[model samples]
Target: MALESLDRSPPPFFRVGFAPLTKLFFFSALSVLLMFGDKQLQFTKPIRAGLSTLIMPVQWLVLQPGQVASSVGDYFQNLDQAQKDLQALQLKQLQQSARAQQVEQLLIENQNLRQLLDLKNTVATPSQVAEILFDVPDPYNQRIVIDKGQTKEVVLGSPVIDAGGVIGQVTRVYPLTAEVTLLTDRDQSIPVMNSRTGARNISSGNIMSGTPLIELKFVPASADVKEGDLLTTSGIDGVYPAGLQVARISHIERRVDISFARIHATPLAELKGRHVLVLQPTGIQAASKGKAP
Candidate 1:
């Protein structure tokens, strides 16, 4: 009896109306029916539109930063691409301009060569085309290596001429390569004859004076030499073939202090190109059939 009098009933808080699973099933079924009705009858269209309109501002606000970031990224990418394109165009323009200048130079060279044809036949110095390898790394002497050597019948002390004029002489020889000392070297000297006046003088490189510095020495103050006179090889030196184009007198200054006139000349050869011609000195035999250009 005392145990029965003690309250055996659960607290009101524990009182249950329906099980959780039962409530879930019932709500699920109701939701399905509502969805079917909304789909088939358009019953919820107005409601959904109203809810969407109410939340649109919030959605846009949340995504605004990402949209702005995407736009900024695209802007930067386009700007970088434009800069690269501009740089490429500038490089292309420079290359075309260089090619145009080269073409013009080649045309002028062609015309001069045509005029020198008779002179070439008169000298009859057979020559072979050679390509320059690289300049010697010395700062004092202007020397370059060439692809032709003893193997190619390129003789030592042979004159190296280009389309325009004499460039250098082959001083050192190897089986497959040779070294050429340009006329501008301080130690170099060439015997030149004036094309206009037939005056014979020794042309020596004065590397200290000016660009491509060369000067005629021992020319008498009263020598029949004048500015703008073309000089050719005098053939006095057995090493160089006779009548090869050499240098032109740029200026002549007479000094009473010295007997020789200070005659400065510029080289006729545009020695900057890779193409060159090497001729075997008159007595030395060549292996390949040659042409004068």
Candidate 2:
């Protein structure tokens, strides 16, 4: 009667009858079998592929709303940013336009003065406006590639100048672009003169503390060169025209122990930013009689 009553009663729902070690052994065996089958038999391939295919649609459906929301949010954010940027660009263009008018007026006056002096007006050569694509990757080269190339009549050895001063020379030409060697590269040299005293010297570039600085070599110790004296190209090389501004004397060091004094010149051109107006060379002969205004 007692056994019958026990059987008739519901078995305890939370009873723990299995031996822990036995259960662990069984699970371990099952896992080992699964891993071995997966590695050696390739038994899971079809199952896994089927499961992947079955769940793919569901997974995509689950993510659809989030994806759509993210896309919409990004589009709106980008639109807002673009609008702000456009307004800022427009304002900058207006300021640049005003400044350009002033520059044009100055150029006109200079042309008139050249004409009156009966001097060869340094003919503005045909030029193509190009954007600097990138800085030269090699630190030793100190160059940049402009978008203008043979298609634009950009030739090698053409002098590249900005509004401030000479930046570099075009050294290599490609089908679609050209490379400009900056004035501050070690291999480059420019014939420069002290604007205040007409003393001629060669400026060579050297890197000091990772910054480009030009050292004026062969300058006489007695040369009247001083800090802040402006230096302009003498144009003796025929590569760079005469009277183009190059740099300003920044430091003059004269040591009795050294035969040559070390002179440093700060480049007039801004090396860190983009510049406008790279003058192309015209093969035309320079008229001998014209004086620069």
Candidate 3:
């Protein structure tokens, strides 16, 4: 009987206030009433707002590391893409610059060809256009090689002229090429007539000057030679045509010690031209359709 009177359960601290099912039903009803009152009246609105405000900074702090990582990744990706774009643009600009240079060079070549064609029409002699291949490698002579030769009916001693005047005379002929000796060459000479005074003289390349030079040989000091005199081919050599420009008297040195006057002339032709006209030698003008004799 005494044992039955003693409590057998745990202490009140461990005891539940209500059964589990009973607590569930009571909390459900209370939650429904609180929700209805919160929606209808404004009793818990300030408390909820205060709780959200208190939690906002914590939520932001929790998301900050992920946001920062995402921004860093985006920054690197944009930088890489920008660098690639810059490189591509630079390459394109270089290609455009090369193309522009090619176009400019082509335009210059076209202008030169047009000038050559115009010069071809002024002379009554049969002529053909020839391209200068390269300069002769001999340093002792001022000579050039042309593309036309025996195969093209390029005759020996044919006079070559550019847009300006006489440049050279064909010296050697091959099957497909020819060599031209310039007027300034050491062994080349031409018969020139002064247009101002009609005086005939022999002009030859000056051997005394190491540079290319043309001077009237053995002209008497009392002759009518003067500076800035225009000289043309006299056509006496039967090689060059008559009245073609050859040179201009640039300087004249009259010395009392010598009987002959020293006269230097500047060549009228452009020596560095790319194209020239090859004219039939005046001696063979009666030939058949400009064919070599």
Candidate 4:
């Protein structure tokens, strides 16, 4: 009967409620101690390091799939963008090729005009069409380099022109390229003429602020010159051929004290653009004379 009573009474540990309460108090104290140690001291460094080392392989395993997916997505996007850029570049090249053909036709017509005038057969020198690689590295100089050079037989002193007018001349040459000094450069000069009256003048460039214009020196004050007259190369120097455009007169100031009149000419061409043509001087025409007995 006593054994049955003891069995019916709860087990010894459950009979004391304080035993479970003591275990709960001990667990809570352990958690608080761990939190305080982590926050206030480096006592858990070794444990943290060990746990990090153990978790590294798991982390790598977890991220591998996401990384591979991201890489594949990025590669495909880059490929698509590259294809689009290539298509755009090809379309631009085709358009430039068509425009080049039109320029060739115009050059042929210009040669025909020279033939009709019985002037020196202005042979448009066979030039290698070169792309303007970059502007002159020096900020003070207004110059540019082209793709053609000694390799392409690009000679020094070749006249550079554009659709509008003369832009510059090739001054320096290298193995794979050449440099062109623009007409607006301070040191550059050209022999020009009044297109309306055929009066010869020398044009020089100046770089002063608010007055960036080519100065026409040695223009006679008595010469019947007017504003807005076109200036073209005279071809006397044998560098640039006759009838090629140079610039247009912008301002003319005549002073009684000064013998020569001051004149400013605005270049007809845009110096910054890529398009340009290099011209070589056509040989001088032979003059005919009456029979000398």
lDDT of 4 by residue, 1-293 (tens): 66765657777876766587899999999999999988899789989899999999999999999999999999999999999999999999999999998798678656543332332233344333456788888756788898888887777888877656788889999999899998888899999989899888888887664555788888788778888999999988767877887888888899999889988888987544454566654432211122333
Better of 1 and 4 by lDDT: 1
lDDT of 2 by residue, 72-159 (tens): 9999999999999999999999999999987886786555444323322342454444667899899777889988888887777777
Error of 2 at 50 (Å): 69
Tell me which of candidates 2 and 3 scores higher on TM-score: 3
lDDT of 3: 0.89
TM-score of 3: 0.69
TM-score, per-candidate, Cα-based: 0.66, 0.54, 0.69, 0.54
**Cα-based lDDT at residue 140, candidate 2:** 78
Measured with C-alpha atoms, the lDDT of residue 249 in candidate 1 is 91
- Candidate 3 local Cα displacement, residue 150, angstroms: 1.9
Cα RMSD of predicted structure 2: 22.4
**Against the unseen true structure, what C-alpha lDDT does each candidate score?**
0.84, 0.77, 0.89, 0.78
Ranking the candidates on lDDT from highest down gives 3, 1, 4, 2
Off by more than 4 A, model 3: 1-107, 136-141, 204-213, 220-222, 253-262, 271-273, 286-293
Itemize residue pairs with steric clashes in candidate 4: none
lDDT of 3 by residue, 1-293 (tens): 78889988999899877899999999999999999998899799899899999999999999999999999999999999999999999999999999998888778667767777887787777799999899989878889999999999999999999877889799999999999999998799999999999999988876467656699989999999888999999999878888889999988999999999989998889754478899999888855546854
Residue pairs clashing in model 3 are none
